[model samples]
Target: MSKIRKKKIKKTNILLGFICILLAVLLGFILVTSYKSEQKESRHLSEIADDQQSGIEDYEAVKERAKELEEISSEEAEDTEDTKDTEKTDTADTEDADKTEDTKDKTTAASGIVCWGDDLINGEESNTYSYMTVLQKLLTDNGYNMTVINKTLQGGGTLSMMKMAGVSDETIQSYITKHQQAANGAQLNVTETGIRDLTEEQTTRNDMDCIPVIFMGYYGGWNHDPAELADQQEQILNTFQNKNQFIVVGTRPMDGSVTSEALDQVLSQKWGEHYISLADVTAQPSSTYEAQQAMAEAILQKLQELNYISKN
Candidate 1:
């Protein structure tokens, strides 16, 4: 055959072998790169899954805590005949109440007042003289045994106040939750008043047979819609299990001046003598201890005038 032909064939074979090796190396590098990419992507997805799981756990825990804070107990029903007719026979009804609200009644079944309000009514934890507290003290000092059960907290707006007052209506709760500003004392900023001793008596929830004094309207405008807030306040009054004499106390609006004025007028008209305004008691109602004293005096005066308590 031919030596040159054999050598040429051998050279072609060598070239083909080199090409095969190069292709194998390139394929291995591509597979290694693909494996590394898959690993990186898997790790990223796992991290995201873990973070989402943690967030869900935190959210569930917060929901549980909120449920606890909003729990309301059913109060024992009392002979609330005196509370049923607050305005119909104002002079006569309260005259009868006076007999039961005096010293003898104190020794028998102590008088109670369930107060529903905001920071102004609850005051701060540091000051023990919330309007309800001071009003209770004033009544006790004046020969009457009165217990004011403060159902309120700081930043507690009308909606949250209603929730804490045993209101479980879904539509109402949803409306408030969506509308109220978180920064204000609307929801989640709840703190309950501990059982306290007033003079010789320990105060208990008197909702079963007690006067409910509602002093709301602290959060508005930037905090919440003043009109909606007023509506919520009205709704709160209806949540009472007993149809009792409920006092509606109004506050000076924090913001939304125009709507606030309108709200004030509407409240006054609807409630009539059953309503009281903080503006009438103080130039500017506040959470201050002094303001609370003024508030107490105002409430005491109202009770005396209404014959809810003995003028003597």
Candidate 2:
């Protein structure tokens, strides 16, 4: 081989080697930059994943807190309902106790007697001294605590007459005046007193505990129709039941020849335990002073039994 050719070949080889080295350096730089960029991307992705995980954990915690709050609310609602029920029960019990106390006080503070009847109780035949006086004396002697106000009238009709009259101040005043006059030993003209006045006085008084009505017949005789008398008596009794008054009923003895068995049955059926038959105490159709006294005793006993007056 020629010398010049050999030298040229060596130069060419050296040049080629330098060029390859330069290419290799550039390739290394590119690879390093690419690797750095990949690493940065990977780190960014990891941060995003961590953020997603934290968000999921936060959501789970929020859900748990909401559940806890719901439980607390439910418990509080139940406690409120229980408290309301207890309060209602306590209020009902208090009301019942108050009602019972009021009833007891009313019974303890009760007083006064309103005597209402016909000539049998008005002492028309006994010189203006009737069974009412006997009853008052008996009650006073037996420790009965009350004021007796006699308002009996001569020829007083059925209970219906009293119911129809109603209550009035004038009637009450008249009775009070008569009572005062009697207390002062003034002779009273009992015949002038009407049935209407007696009934009005009975209905007007607020202090009376008991009012016993003795009915014989209308117009001072048992000659009236039995059915008509019974019906009127029934009406009066029903009306009196609606009133704020305690009432007792009594029947006077009629003529033995007269059929009073029907009337007695009606009184027993209508009044039940509140009825008193004077036939058992007196045999005479018209009551005498002794009979009136006996009737007064019976009336007092009946009042005690009916709880209108305390049995001492």
Candidate 3:
């Protein structure tokens, strides 16, 4: 072919590629814009449906659809809140849960509470509320500006939790391999409806420093060993590197022998006011929805006493 013809072909190809690139960029912009708009509209509708906002009298169909969407979202959050929360009711049943992977980083964002623990914290899968779920609602309803992060492992025990924190020995670390998904199906749950993103203000507040809530359930075997359990509890607590940035929650003791007397004593004594035991909060620390609400209430009370948060 002539050099002129060759030059023309090359130019045609170059122009076509540029057009294709332009088209791709335009398409991507359109998709992202649409997604963002939909999200905004959805949020508006949800605010109305949830009765958090008003003045939509002319948009009855939109209101109805929003209600349906809100209901669906509520159901999804309820159904999968298990992050095998399938059996938080019985300790024996907890062994069936399978979890892998770690939470990735313990150096957290300071805009919220980081809750870590086992089934009791995870709550039962069928139930609508884990303590984190209840806590999120409580904070929002009571006019607090903190997010609640649920990092509970459904069947995770003391050793498993230690591994998640990367505080335990290599033996235990190799044993669990990776941590489980959270009880609420998402690693970070800010709402009962599912995981929600943090606001820019919430995320950037005070340099992303987060308050850690430490709550670990016992291992399945011979969970009645308080002294040994106390030592394990101590190990996990020390890993936070800053005692002042976290709160420790003692689970309902295992038959009052395994946890209450020995476990709670060790934690409370060492951590002093930084610790709160469910034993003091409730004689029954069952994982029912109501019980979870009670747990959230107790946590809020403790936060008030600590002055970690205050009503706005």
Tell me, by TM-score, which candidate is best.
Answer: 1
Q: Which runs in model 2 stand beyond 4 Å of their true positions?
A: 1-108, 121-129, 167-247, 252-258
Kindly list the per-residue Cα lDDT of model 1 for residues 1-312, writing each as its tens digit.
Answer: 699999999999999999999999999999999999999999999999999999999999999887766552212122245455555589777777886566344423424667776765332553577787778788888887667776765664454565555555584446645544443553432222111122212123346456677777665421344455556666766765434456777776554443435656877777778777776677744667777788878887776665555433
Candidate 2 residues 115-203, lDDT tens each?
Answer: 55465633245444477777788889999876666555555544324444353445434544544455476543332233344445555
Indicate whether candidate 2 or candidate 3 has the larger lDDT. 3
| lDDT agreement with native, every candidate | 0.63, 0.59, 0.61
Top candidate (lDDT): 1
Decreasing lDDT order of the candidates: 1, 3, 2
The runs of at least 3 residues in candidate 1 whose Cα sits more than 4 Å from the true structure, single-residue gaps closed, are 1-110, 121-126, 177-206, 221-227, 241-244, 256-260, 310-312
TM-score of 1: 0.51
- 1 or 2, which is superior by lDDT? 1
- Flag regions of model 3 displaced more than 4 Å: 1-109, 121-127, 171-208, 220-224, 252-259, 310-312
Each model's TM-score, in the order given? 0.51, 0.47, 0.47
Residue pairs clashing in model 1 are 155-185
Candidate 3 local distance difference test against the native: 0.61
Q: Please list the Cα RMSD from the true structure of every candidate, rounded to 1 decimal place.
A: 28.9, 11.9, 37.8
The whole-model C-alpha lDDT of candidate 2 against the native structure comes to 0.59
| Position 291, candidate 2: lDDT | 68
